[model samples]
Target: MGALDYVLAGVAAVFLGPEMFSLFGLPVSLALAMVVLGFLTGILVGATPGLGGPMAMAISLPILISLFGYSADALLPVMGFLIGVMKGATVGGAVPAILFNTPGTADAFMTTLDGYPMTQRGQARKALKVAHVSSAAGDTFSDIVLIVCAPFLAIMIERFLDLPEKTALLLLSLSFIATVVGGSAGKGLIATGLGLLAAFVGTGEDFYPRLSFGTEALSQGFGPAAVFLGVLIVGELFRGIEDLWREKARSGQVTQYDLSGDQSLGWADLRRLAPHIGRSALIGTAIGALPGIGSSLAATLGYTVAKARHKPGAGDPKMGEGAPEGVAATEAANSAVSGANLIPVLSLGIPGNVAAVFLILAAESIGGFTPGPSVFRFTETAVNPELVIAFGLFTMMMLANLMNWTVGGVFMRSLGFLVRVPRQLLLPVVLLLTLTSIYVETPRFEVILFTLGFGVLGYLMRRVGMSPLPFVIAYILGGRLEETARQAFAATGADPFFLFNRPVALALMVLALLVIVWSVRPKGEAS
Candidate 1:
């Protein structure tokens, strides 16, 4: 595996060799360019009210695939870009949430609770700056966790786990995700079950395709990218456009803000937030490590915990009034989760969220890399002294953050001007970009059709009380769960009790059952 890792790295370097050169006595390596691009992309995606990191990645993947070709060298920049989007979007959500009382993403909803109030009081600059700094701090801290814990966790799994245990571990991971995410125990279980079912929609082993609906495309494995784009990106775009139209019909003017004030924070303000940063970072990292939990939940949880932990008469001026600490806590927690989410994906090959699942898919499509313990082995071989690759990844993320903070800040501050552009002009530009990007990836009209179809489904789901998170999560984990179950069954000659024979598997099954029961029990009865 180590040798294979080196070979892959070598191949990546070779493919990217032409792009590497010296400029101003600094190594302008291909990796460096990718990192910068990742950062820029993040800023662009984050600053937009409706756009998000995942959507940005979806749009970029196709373009990158066509331009760079499918190789690790090509893939690394895209990964860097995703990292940038993650960091940028974490903070960027605050913009619309604070100014217009519209959350760009669910995670930023908490921010708007107080943030918009501050804006109404003409403290928009202060709120924006606090949100930005706090987000950066949280994201940086989470990256530190990734740097420290990923290798250790990977080694533990690689050294100790057998197939049964690994399978059990993945099941346990899924259980934890469902428990933490769905809020109620029953809903989580139901959601997980639903996710598993969704994952089974395409072809499986045994030369049987389970739920293809007699379509030829169904006989082949479905494209994960297509599904993600359709359900998440396209759906959101349509919804955004519809909302824009509604806003137009109701009010002749789109929301606008004033950011001319000097709202920069001093060292004293930062010092006040230092304590909360530490706590929020921990919360975020822990939540991120768990499967199914997303950054938005982490942000809300961080805010709640921060409020709870406030000292009597600490008189945090920002509490409920959009205090800087509120921004810091939520931002840190949400941003930290980004790095933490990657831990499970890189170390154990289990995706913690929809973005991570897409990352795994992209890695497979471009680099032929299967994420898990084996990734470490192969990376060690391909890049040698695996630390270099790790360091490279870390460097890329750091660079992305730096770029995001500096460039993104300016862009956000200037957003008041950009939003001034007529909706008539802006909407068309956005639509064109979306259509062009979609076409570049699939080049099939059917892909666009599916995208629109899923977009409507997404809109409808939102209209109902259902969250799209569970559906997306289910879609991602579906295939893996089935494969593991099948493998377990085959190893035991299809014996129903075989899964129970193994202690680890038995334990997981018991725990999952207990969770299901506990989740369904009357709320007050158990708690």
Candidate 2:
């Protein structure tokens, strides 16, 4: 096909979508339906404290593959649902943080600092509105950038970056992630190393599996779906249940509340928050482009910047005490990350955060698409199906943003009744669902045990103040990194110092070294 033909085809793929059904005499694609479902599900998940975007994605991944089939044609609809969940979850997370004193997701922790205080002062509705607007606007901005940048960056990487450079870039990404993903670089490095070790088991081209230790299941390798669900979702679920027990023991019943807050937000309110939202969106977009760094940092940095620069308006609540701008600032930054997190995933096959890790899993499980520069290649001889899926996923995110604008307020308000649901009741249901989802993916009981082992490891890691993110991301990238490094070595004739053969590779390694040093540097030394 010609360029125009491809463009038209891509546009059609995006709008028409796959998995169609009739809706009142109109044919509606499941991709479109998923946008709505995913957004509503996001609200449900994000309004509840134990769930997050990754957990939603994890639970849906195997089920989506089963429904859509492991064909290239299934890519669009599955990806569409995933992208929708991502956008919706980011927006919905602020709801609980505003309505109750609890944050629904890790990234929403900052929102609670200002949001719950607003609730205490009878501005709960206003806080929710600010959060909703900022989240939608910021998400839209980031999605636009993803639309423009993902393709361009993919093309650039394809054209100029050879295997050596790619390998080095991957290394740099890992180095940066290990250093900067969370506090205590030593712990981060340890977690990442453990991930790499775990991922290597039963996975390789060699006749003898790298780390399987002679077990049949280990030799076969654990699927990403199993590992991530174990580490991210199940692990968090375990912790959440423990937390619920503690909460139940501490306070059997919680205080009830009436919605007495001023729910109205005027145009003046929008004007007031416009600057903070804009600044944080841009900041979040930039951060999202980098590999491994996550929305929590984006939210924190945005809140920090807003606090430093903001001057309280006369008779207006201060930013920290209960300011609506504080909600906007926090939400916008975290929401902006929803799109930007895809940049590396779409362009270089590097997942930027936990959510992006599931996106990779979805793409892999559904088949027909691989997330990398190759996926973006324009082949005139044949149709590039992955590109079409990419466009379709992009469309799904926009639809989600539109949903956030239209029905999000009603949904958040509706969930006000659920803000105080007993966690003791809630967590058991989540655990059962998680177990069922995993069983659906693999009928084997041992797989469940293996996953539980990882979950226990994850829980202990968190209990000891270590971040699980680095471990998850590192595990996902480890085998790929090894494969690329081997390719580069083979290309350079098996030299031990093969990376030194390319100046670009050498420079990238140096950069990685510098970033590791900077990330691990002591706070006292810096001061």
Candidate 3:
């Protein structure tokens, strides 16, 4: 099949797939229905203070797998839902930040600076409109880039890289992620090492398990669903519960707002905000294309740049003082990050952020869809199913963007009540839901125990200022890394220093070392 033929086949697979039910006498594809459902659910979770996109994705993944089962036919519907959650949550996060000065995640913090101020000035609706429009536009721009660039990048990777080179490239990616993801390079490395250690505990080439210690349970290692939910969702819930306990009185208080005046976003308003949106969209896409940088940094950079360039006139607000442009800049940048983060995932099989992690996890669990250069291969005689699935994913994202542009604003603006739901009540419910869902999937008590154990580890990591992102990514890639290294060694006729023999591989390893050394350098010397 040619590239164009693969693209069309993918579109047909999504639109003409198995029917979930009939809507208005027309058959509704299961993937299409799940996308819409996930989008709406994403908005609800994103608006809540203690819940965000990653947590929702982690909690829902187990349930999704249980319901759909492990079949090739289940991949599209499962992936479509996850993609919807990712896109919807990016836009929904701005709602609570604008109306209630509550940010569900780090990326939404910048939105609160100007968003809450706008609410105080009775421009809450206007701020939300600006956020929604800017978010939709930025996301659209990033998706187009991903659609155009992923296949080209993947093809280039397939053409230029051999096994040894690929192994070295993976090392470079891991090292770069470890150094850049957290406050201290040392702590990040520690987290990465621990993740790799945990991943190595189960099976290997030997007849016996590598690190099982003669325990029957450890022989199988940890389940991916349990590990992800424990570290990402359960761990956060534990921390939130503790924080809320300390500030019970303050957390319980609810403030009422009189939202009135200039609620409409007119053509003139969009014209004024266009420059900020465009600049931040570019900034965010560039940053998000790199592994481990994340949307929080993009939001911060976007807000800082827009603030520096902002010139307030008479009867106008300053950048952080109820300016609609402030909301637009932050929201646009963070939203843009969500789509561009998928570029590395599709091209190199490397996840760049928490949301991308789940997408990779879904593909791994579902099987029949390996996310790498091979996924984009076009063969003349045989049909490439992964290529069709890739196109199907792009179509799902476009569907999500369409929903965002049409009815998303109306739905987002009506979510002010979510801010009033205290974490004290919400955290326990989420914890219970997560545990119950995990039990339903595996129906084993030991799996729950493993999840709790990992949850404690995750909580401690958070308390010590270490980010879990590096750990999670390392865990996901550890087995693949080992397999590639083994292949590279065999391919080079059992050469001990095979990496140093190839110029590209040697250069990548040297670059990886330099990245770590540079990250640990003194601020004055580095500058």
Per-residue CA lDDT of candidate 1, range 373-405, in tens?
665553422443333344456666767667656
Point out where model 3 deviates above 4 Å: 524-527
> Relative to the unseen true structure, what is the C-alpha lDDT of residue 416 in candidate 3, on a scale of 0 to 100?
81
lDDT of 3 at 217: 88
For each candidate in turn, the TM-score is 0.85, 0.95, 0.98
TM-score ranking, best first: 3, 2, 1
Clashes of 3: 0
**Model 2 per-residue lDDT at 110:** 93
> What does candidate 2's lDDT look like per residue over 1-527, in tens digits?
66456556766775676647787887787678776877788777777766777788888877887887877667777777777778777877887788777787778999998998888887788888899999989899999999889989999998988888889888888888888877777888899898898888897887998788887878878767667877887788888888766766585454544567468988988998999999999989999888777888899889999988789968877878988888999999999988998999999888888888888887776667789888787778998877766766776777788888899767866776666777778777877777778888788887788788888988888888788888888888898899998998898788778666788888998998999888766687521
Residue 161 of model 3, lDDT score: 89
Error of 3 at 187 (Å): 0.8
* Separate clash counts for every candidate: 15, 0, 0
Candidate 3, pairs of clashing residues? none
Clash count, predicted structure 1: 15
CA lDDT of each prediction against the hidden true structure: 0.68, 0.82, 0.89
- 1 versus 3: better TM-score goes to: 3
TM-score quality measure for candidate 1: 0.85
